[model samples]
Target: MEIMHAVDFRTQLTSIMETLAKTAVVEIGKLFEENSSFLKLEITRCTRENESLQQKCRLLESELQAARKTAGKINRTEASLSHGSTGCICVDICTPTRLDTGNCKLYITNTLHACFPDTAHRPAIDNVFGKDWCLNLWRHEESNAAPNEDTNLSSSGVTVEPVNLLEEEPDMIMIKEEAFEKCSSDKTEEDQNKRLRGAIQKQVKEILPELDLKKLQNVVNHLVYVVGVEKIDDLTFVEVTDLKDFLEPIQCRKLVKTLKQKDFFQESNEQDETPTEITLTPLSSIESIPEQPFFPYCPANSEWLQRFQIPWDRMPPALTQATATGQRARPGARREFVRIVVAAMQAICPNPNLAACREVARWIVSTYPLTFGDITEEGEQLGNGYSCLQRQLKTRVEHVNRDIMEHRIRRPRKGLATKRGADEESYVGKKFRNCKADSYGCVNWQPSSIPEGETPNSLEMKRKVAAEIFQSAGPRAVELTNVDDLMQQTYVYQRHMINSCPPPSISEIELSWPFLFTERGLCRHFKTLTGIDIKSRFGETLNAKAKRILNYFNSQRLRWNEEIQSLLSEIDSDSDGTDNNKTAISAILLMMKYFKEKETSIFISADATSTKMSIEKEMTLPATPRLIMLGNSLLTSSKWFISIEGRVSHSIDSQLDFAAALAVFFGCFYVFNIEYEESAIATLELIQRFFVRINTEGTKCTSKSGTSRKTGSAVQRKSQNFHPRVATFMQRLSEFEWKTSN
Candidate 1:
């Protein structure tokens, strides 16, 4: 029974599966048929709609065409009307009719008769306007006849005249009316002035917000005075009337008085009993009071008053005796005393020379015992020999003081002496190493190893020891292999230390190497070593070279003597020359030739000869002429003459010489060299002189004879020759000539 039940269940499941598959197929077919029918109905509806839209489109297009035609007709009618109104149209017709009739013909015919009343009795309308005009007139008349059809005409039954419609109103008359109305409504001068003042006050309040009304009024009044009434009126947005009324009499008087006080004006004195004519005194004629005297005196009767006035009462007996008779043992004793007092006074007051003499003389006469015999025992002995001298001194002082006060003599100014050789003295001897050693030791003083219980061998040993110790802890210790390496590494390390150390001194490192010592060299080295360049090192380079060159120049006694001799010879030749002017000209010509051969682009210029002047007189060329020539030459050649002289003067500085030499070389190359390949060589050579290290102590070979001659043996022995290609190139350039256009 279980097996039969299983078979029946399997059969029922298979039948159900078959039935579902069949139903699915039928449903799919029915759906396809319904979709197809629906699509057909939609297509039919779309086609009908399209046809209706087409009909509507055609109707709209037809209406647009009719409107365009109507607009074109209207435009033509308007053009014809414009032409007819201009009286340039004519039309011919058998009978006169309002419909499309030429109105221009009638106007022309009427106007022709009006213009010439005495001519032929009547003129044909066509004579005024021909057939073309008549056609235009007809079109205009037609347009005018159909009043409703005219697009430009008004809705009223009457036709709008084109002339009336196109006519523009006169703008000038309208503008005049507007201006008149504005003028009538404008404020009066008085009101405008009031408003201007109010505006000024308001602006002042805004600017100086803290100021009071009274202060603002005062400022405004000042401004008004500074800027005259005419100027104020022009600047301000206000009207002016009776400007004089705005100013007070007192203020006007003050202004006039101030103007009269100026140096250019003549001032009248109102205080004079008789009215004096105002006059101006010449500035040159105005006299000043003289500050010295011609006569002097000492009062004899004022001894008691003089004694009371003196600050010191119980002076030495000698001084008292000298004071008693107003006598002094020394010659010019009073003058010396006056000078000392004057000097002290000058320290207090710059202009006290006159005061010193008067004050001292007055004090001396009034405070001292005056009588020659009025003296104590000690004073008597001193007075006996000095009485007359003292009297003379006092008299002279008195006279000088009086003359100074009375303007009888002029004061002489003291002369000032030049302080040329002023210098500070060092406590140490002159030989005490000019090296600047501050907290840091001298760069020359390197430390060296010394035995524990022994003194260093010398300063050099001590320096070595210090250097070794410094290197051990320095940044380049690993790179320092040998003494040479140590020296090079030490230099870099010391330089860095000097740079990093606070308040570096001048003698932190001894820059003795010629090329390495220079600023350019150091810059090059720094760039090569550290890949960084700096500009401040240029002065260091120049300074290092300057010191070496200066030392060399100063030390060579023979060279100095030779230079002196050469200079003396040149001076003597200049002094003895008969035609100095010709000689100077010759020198200039020679210089020009030399520079030209060298391919230098500099030119020599002299003034055109006007009159035959003496050689001596002509030799002294005017500085202005030379300067003008220099400027012209520079402009023409596009190169400057660095060293310029009048055949007599030498360069003031070494840099000038170097610059002049370099310019000459550069100018030459630019003028001659079509291919500037050798230019770089010359430039490099010149630049090297500024930075290259030269071994000055290197062996120099010279021939025994005064002139050096190349011998066969010498040529054979020559191992190396370093003649720069630039030198050879420049030599060849001497033959080249510059071509100019005709």
Candidate 2:
């Protein structure tokens, strides 16, 4: 029994040990699988992190390159190139988050120009800024953090904190409130003094309304310069004594009393006026000085200082005084001035004419002329003066061009000579076009020539006498405003212009645009078209008959002219006949009426200056004119014209608005009719005065008539998705298939 019990205990122990061993193996296998899965996940997370960092680095590098390119442009040198793209983030205030590309520099440059026009004249860009205005107005860097030099941002311990793209945080923002300082503290004081003086003038006006306020302000400004205090109450004993020089003691007391009564030293918060920051280049004490230094060092002074100084060579008689207004000396005119000198020199020669390309270096001097010899027009070269003149001329041309494109009607400023005499009242109706007081000064009439002493013969004698007469009347020239006397002077000027050219035997009549509305329009048109006067068989004046014809034409029944209308009237009664000359007159009147009523009319800009009047005028038309045949007559008769959207196509070119177009059309008409006239040659002279841009692009304006178009291509284009209203308008406007046929 003891042996059996011992054997059973041994078997039970062995079974328990086997069960424990199996459980341990299973647990170990499960732990190994979990560890392998964790390792795979960790690897993937690290790889993704590395990729994201690489992308950020690439982004940073590209932005840096773009900033460097922009900084290379003008005015970018003001900001730190290092801080351009780094831990220092630049938020373009104009367009935040979006990279500026080039607009940043352009906006700043334009703003600077608007502020200081003298910047254009100055040699250095740095000199353009006012001392009060901060140069770094556009940029603001992290004030606290020093800019780090680590090109590889990853290495730097200084982390680039992620910015909120949608909103600007206080510290992250670059532009501070006080970035731009408009005026210095001194200027503010000067302005305050001016205001005080203005108030004083108003208060004292009842008793002393005639007081010169500007004069009073000048006195106070000078006092401010010497006193060196902004607040009026802060004036020291010395300043008071200095003020006494200009103002009486009682006056000074009253001024001070009034200022203190208003609490002028302590400005009220209630004042809502805009900050008067900019003045029209107000001169400080130092700038107002005539001489640059205390005593300028010059050869003129040296000559005067010497006891035995040689007499300074001077002109025997003074030619002219230095007048403030811009007026050239009246170089005398020759009989052939229009044909010879004025017509000889071309302002711009795009395609070189060898004869016209000869050197103008004799007229314009050069620096170090020995090394840099005479430059010819053929070489497209310019000396200092010539280059400057060309630059100014180009600027004016561009200005006029921009006006034509944008305004499409009239310019702001008018002609100095013609506008006042003809339609000065027209200008008075507009907001900005009202004639300025100073703008209407001396009658400095154009075509004013001073005689060249080149010919000392009979020509020179005649010019000398004319010049002497002008010189004797110099004071009168200055004195005479728009009085009736100036009209006689203008007639004299007109005489000088017309002597060389013979009068047209063809009953010439020059009518202004306004004169067309009167009865004179038909009379003038008849005379010019037929080369005949309005005289009957018995030599009786038949002006009344012309008036009747004008009235009939005004009724729109006389489509061509009075003669054509009479024939049409007779046709109504079964008797018909029409004259070709009458058709020409009808065409002219039809064109003129259509032009006057046009929605987008080409106006002769009153701002057309003397030197560049033709350029300004010719550019007013959007497109050049083309000859069209109507009824196979070959002549571009007035009937060739037709209306589009109440706009006349041929009228723009046919009118005297563009001299070149008029000459081209009229000359073509005459040649087509197999007739020659001296008038064509004279009109050619007028055409030469203008600088016209010939449209060689082959891109025809939809508004223009008789444009040669390409055909033979069958193109059924796919439909576009334009707005309903826009599509309808375009459809109506582009219906030029019939009208545009050549």
lDDT of 2 by residue, 271-388 (tens): 4242323232222322221111111112331232222211112211111221111111111211122112212232232221211211222121121121122122121111121222
TM-score of 1: 0.13
Candidate 1: give its CA RMSD in angstroms.
Answer: 49.8
Predicted model with the maximum lDDT: 1
- Candidate 2 collision pairs: 330-450, 331-449, 331-450, 331-451, 332-449, 332-450, 332-451, 415-606, 560-586, 587-638
Worst 10 residues of 1 by lDDT: 694-703
Q: What stretches of model 2 exceed 4 Å from their correct place?
A: 1-174, 180-197, 200-210, 232-240, 248-742
Candidates in order: C-alpha RMSD to true structure: 49.8, 41.1
Query: What local lDDT does model 1 show for residue 89?
Result: 29
In order, candidate lDDTs are 0.33, 0.31
The count of residue-pair clashes in candidate 1 stands at 31
